[model samples]
Target chain A: MDIEVIKRYLPLFSKAFLLTVKIGWLGIALAFVLGILCAFTLYYKLPVLSTIVRFYVELFRNTPLLVQLFFIYYGLPSIGIRISAQLCGTLGLGLLGGSYMAESIRSGLEAVPAIQSESAKSLGMTKWQAFRYIIAPQAFNISVPGLMANVIFLLKETSVFSAISLMDLMFTAKDLIGLHYNTTESLFLLVLFYVLMLLPVSFAGSLIEKKVRFGMYGD
Target chain B: MEEILKVEHLHKSFENLTVLEDVSLTVNKGEVVVIVGPSGCGKSTFLRCINGLEDIQDGRVILDGQTINPPLQKGDNYRQRIGMVFQSYELFPHKTILGNIMLAPIKVQKRDKNEVRAEAEQLLEKVGLSSKKDNYPRQLSGGQKQRVAIVRALIMHPEILLFDEVTAALDPEMVREVLDVILELAKQQRTMLIVTHEMAFARAIADRIVFMDGGSIIEVSEPERFFTEPRTERAKRFLKTFEY
Candidate 1:
């Protein structure tokens, strides 16, 4: 356990940390938007579109994230669609997170009672207007806790991005251990790095849960 | 007098169970019709049909002389002009009382905000809920919620109002508050069709009493006669327990 070896790898860890943050941030934003769209299609029972969305969710949710990332990073090139490893990692995380988000949002939509929809209709709101105003706001509140949990899980899943040569936090740690031949110390710090990445997400998720509860159910 | 609503041979059934059968009635402009019957007699279903909330299987309903059979064509059709209040006080729980009242006028009618707000304030006062304007539905008592619902319905300035046992959800003490508001509306001669089992309420303010049973109106008469004579045997039996 050489202290100097860990100290020398600090700058590499910082660069890897930035890549990890980039992957998580971009993946979550894209996943959240895609998830909401998928949830809307599923909730409304749109013809054809709903079926395709269900298939996409099933495919991503059932398979292993590591395997999914490998397929995207390795398999795509054989099919003549070459892309950067970083882009592949992002797309993999987005698809994985989007699937879980769809389920969370669907549960949220189901939580709204039939009476609310009728009341909206009675007010002469069009179908889309009713969904946008009444159903969407309420559903967002209902699903916040679950979606926030999904976000934390997504952050951990970003670790799989290391296998695809993205130089994310885990990959940087693995390279340092290889160069320095110190598995115990490097692995311990890697675990700490991951814990640090997820701490803010978990904290922020709870804050959102609190805000959603107040907005929806009040004090 | 021009009629406000006319139902001819209205029949509705869900799956295999028939709810309403061959129901025909006419409501005159400025008239208040009170529909009373035993549970499962389809009184609420009848009210829902008039507002186009439920589709009738076999009959035509003419509202203010226009047929309500076909789904209304988009825009320029303000079937919302006919407002309804429910037994559940189905006020929008997420909104303040003022928000509930302003929703229809602003969104449906596209009325100016200040004008709608002033009108909402006046309606809330009329329903005796002016002080609770900022409270959410969950924050109010059942009686207060129903009062806001009444104000929400009336703010649309609907040509006719339908009350479906609005006081049914309230405690005995709170029922008087809701009935008093309805009585005030009756005093103003707002066209309304109310469904209730409160005989004294039906007798006190209703212009006409319609006794229904098994999805048919067996007797329709002036309040005094319907309560006193009750020509049909069913009406007579039904009135026996409700004797004041």
Candidate 2:
């Protein structure tokens, strides 16, 4: 392992790391929002929308993210619509992560007893008020820790974006290995960069979990 | 006192199973009615039907001269007028005791925060839980949770209060605290339909005691006569269970 090759690759790797972060941020945020909306639609039992959401969740959950990414990035142009690779990659991540996230949030919604709504209603709250004030907050609290942990996997999943030439961290590492004829340093740095990125997120999730967990079941 | 609530020829079912069959009762304003029956005999369902939490297949629930059922009444009226407490306490766990008490008043009633908070604090004091105002439901004991649930109901200033075995979830020692709160509220002449198996508490607070079996009211009599001289065979059989 030549220290000099690693030194030379550091600038490129750092730039790729930033790209990975940017994609992860956009994809995870979109997924979280989309997932929550799907969960709410299922929970509130919207008529046609609920059916559509269920079908969407099933379709995404059952398929491979890579296949979905390829179709978006590679398949769309053949049909006359052209989009950027990053946009396609981000959309693929959002669509894929959203299905699992919907399941997680649905479980969170179920964890709240039906009686909460009944009690809220009995107190003269409107159904919308009950949902907004009582049910949604508790459900979010129940979902936050698990969903935050999911973000780590989401970040790791960004590696798939490199397949579409998105210039993410994995692509940078692979490019360097090809150019410098060095595998050990590239792989080691790749693992180290992910660790550096994920450890703080994991720590923050655990911290939030503890804060919400306090006075949750017992003081 | 005028009639505040009346259940007429009510029947409720879940899919193929009928839980309440041809049940009817009347509650006058400022009346305390105690309903007791074996488990699964539809005691709680009766309370829920009054609050419109459960749908009825037949008949109506009249509240303040207005029909409070779906076909005639808006969902808002039943909710605003009828307050209910569950066997499980059903206090919002994520909210503080004060937040649990204040939510409906502020959000639904659109009341001023300072005024509502002051009123909530007074209710907490009334329940002897003023110190627990800032506490979450999980921070309190079973008795305290029940007390907070009571305050939550009372804060709504409901026309009628329905309690579904509020003490059933508590320890034996905790039951009295909740019953005391109910009895205190009873003294203030709040209309209440309480479903409880605590016959002693029922006899103390109830103006009328309803005995139900097989989803039907077997007897409805004043507390003293019903306990001492039950008229129906079912009531006699029911009372006989506690004799030992």
Candidate 3:
């Protein structure tokens, strides 16, 4: 609550905020790529790979992100596989978010009626062409809200990055409180930074949803 | 007359339930053959089988002297020769009406974009939908959507067009607009195999009427004789429902 303390902590908090945003977006991007690939595998029911994707989705979705981070950061080095703390935080968040994204994308793919593909095929389109032009666009429009939710969820999950020794917002806030006993100011800044990170994503998601909906059926 | 498409002994079933049993029909070039029957009689299934959309247990669909293999490949060439319009329209919701019509020609056929767009616009005009060229499917009425579906198929210039109850989903007022498009196509000597419940339209449009019951053709006769004298007892019963 002290103005002096608030000003003093701003630079540290800003640095931490940048790190959190950087790692969060990188993880979410990885998640999207993995999710899209996994969803396509599951949708096509591809041999061997689909089963592996299914197992991966279940594994990541069922477990906690904190435990995932721990395993990636602490447990891998035990087997002589060394990964930096930042990479661990990003990978852990990505792998976990990927599963949710896969489910969201899969549901979107399914929601597109069978008739759409059938119509495309009847027009002499190959399975790939039909999926690319007819199915994928509609599925992507359907998945926007769910994907945006995952984005926000994964960003909020960056709080656990502190456990892996990443210099994210939560880690900086906790470090300040332990040093200066300025818990109120630290927590306030933490909340402020998190909102600043998530609000635009939430706003952008709705905008995309509206645009997709409008594109689907004009006014 | 030269035969454009011939279906021989088509048999289709979903698991234990038989949908089309030993259905066979031949369409000559420039012929308008209409198939009519009671609900669940496999009229739609028969069209789907001919289009290679449904897997047939036993039969052959020969188009342009080539037998169509169901599992032929990812994008079989036979399907390009057989255009189909569904009962639900099935126009791509994300695309404009012009996009819907131009897609197969440009993408699958690898035709020139400007030429396909011009042909699409002409087809849309023929169907009285040129004004809706830039409109999405959801913005249009069911009848308008069906017209777009027809134009989408017509733009392909398939050797044979199959329409499965295209007017079955439209409002009473809307049905006429769609049926009129098909009638105009028939006048142009486009070979089409149609399934419909509109008896009057069928009588007017069909060169030959195929009456089906219980997954098999009960009668195939000239429309003039079929409507007035209906040879089969089932046909007699079916035509009676439309009497009132």
Candidate 4:
């Protein structure tokens, strides 16, 4: 409960906070792009790749994300593939985020009626062109709300990275508490950091969803 | 008259139930043919097959002297010449009315944007929607949306225009507005195949009236002859449903 000890650990926590932001942002960007591609594959019912993607989604979505991370970082090095801890965490989070985001996008695809796709095709659009110009933009708008929720969950899941020694905010918080024995102060700061990260995303997502709904329903 | 579209022995079945059986028809240049039948008579399916929207189990649909079904994939260049409008007015809800009209012209025909925009403006004006260029489909009424859909189809400068029950979903007051735009297109000597329940509209604008029943055309005649002299018993029975 020493105030001096808490103050000494502050700089380290801030550094870890910045790292957390970098990892989460990078992980989310990679995951969203990958997830959109995965979503399109499933939406179009592409030949063999659709089946393969389904398996990937189920495997990642069903298991605990922590286990997936541990298996990647700790389990894989036991074999021959040795990835950096940061890369492992990022990849693990991306894969996890991609699965949920893909499903979010898939649900958006379902919301669009079959007639719309047919309309695009009859207008002489190639399948890929129809998807790119017509389907994808609408689907992205429809899925934004669900995607934001997934991202918020992803931000929290970044905590699991602490277990792998990536030195994220949560990891630094626990380490500071272990050293200073100031549990209340350390945990409170950790909570505050998470809220700061999440509020903007939540607010921005809601605003976007409102715009999409307005575009779809007119008012 | 020059033949613009030819369908030869087209047959389609969905899970063993025949939707269109050995259907064959021809449309001449600048001709407007109205197909009238009861619901589920395969009129819409027949129209869809011509554009490669519905697959036919047998035979081919030749448009502008090219087989469109299993389109010459050599380059898929033929799609640039044909366009379709749906009954639901499937305007891309995400895009503005201007975007809807400009899509096929810019994307398929690869027309210059400035030129396409000018052409789209004219098209919007033709459809009586010049003021709605920036509005989304969701902002328009059913009639306004259908007009935009018609303009979207026309901007492609298609050799043939297919109207699939264009006014079925409109309010009684909105029906005339859509038919007015379509009737105007008809006057332009566009090759048009309209599937409609508006017996009176058919009576007015159709140069030829085709009566379809059980997936086959039972009678094809001038609208005057069609109203006065229906050949098949089914056509006679179908005619009785409408008090024309």
Q: Pick the candidate with the highest TM-score.
A: 3
Instruction: Quote the lDDT for B57 in model 2.
Output: 96
Candidate 1 TM-score to native? 0.91
Candidate 2 ranges beyond 4 A from true positions:
A1-7, A44-55, A182-185, A217-219, B71-75
Task: List model 2 lDDT by residue over A1-219, tens digit each.
Answer: 778877877887888888888888798988999999999899879999999999999999898888899888889999998999888878988998898799889889988888898888888777888888888878878888779867887888988888999888899889878887689889878887888778988898888877876656542
Q: Which candidate number would show the highest DockQ if scored against the true structure?
A: 3
Model 2: per-residue Cα lDDT over B130-217, one tens digit each: 9998888988899999889888888888898999999988999999999999999999999999999999999999999999888889
Name every residue pair that clashes in candidate 4. Answer: none
With candidate 3 superimposed using the best TM-score fit, by how many Å does residue A106's alpha carbon deviate from the native?
0.4
Report the candidate with higher TM-score, 1 versus 2: 2
Q: Which is superior by DockQ, 2 or 4?
A: 2
DockQ of the two-chain complex in candidate 1:
0.45
TM of each candidate vs. truth? 0.91, 0.93, 0.94, 0.93
RMSD values for the candidates in order, in angstroms, are 2.6, 2.2, 2.0, 2.3
**Would you list the rank order by DockQ, best first?**
3, 2, 4, 1
lDDT of 3 by residue, B1-244 (tens): 9998888998999999999888888999999999999999999989888888888999888887888845455545678788899999999998888889989999999999999998988888888988999888998999999999999998888999999999989999999999999999999999999999999999999999999999999999999999999898999999999887
Clashes of each: 0, 0, 0, 0
Q: Please provide, for model 3 over A50-110, each residue's C-alpha lDDT reduced to its tens digit, 9 standing for 90 to 100.
A: 9999999999999999999989998999999999998898899889999999999999999
Regions more than 4 Å wrong, model 4: A1-7, A46-48, A207-214, A217-219
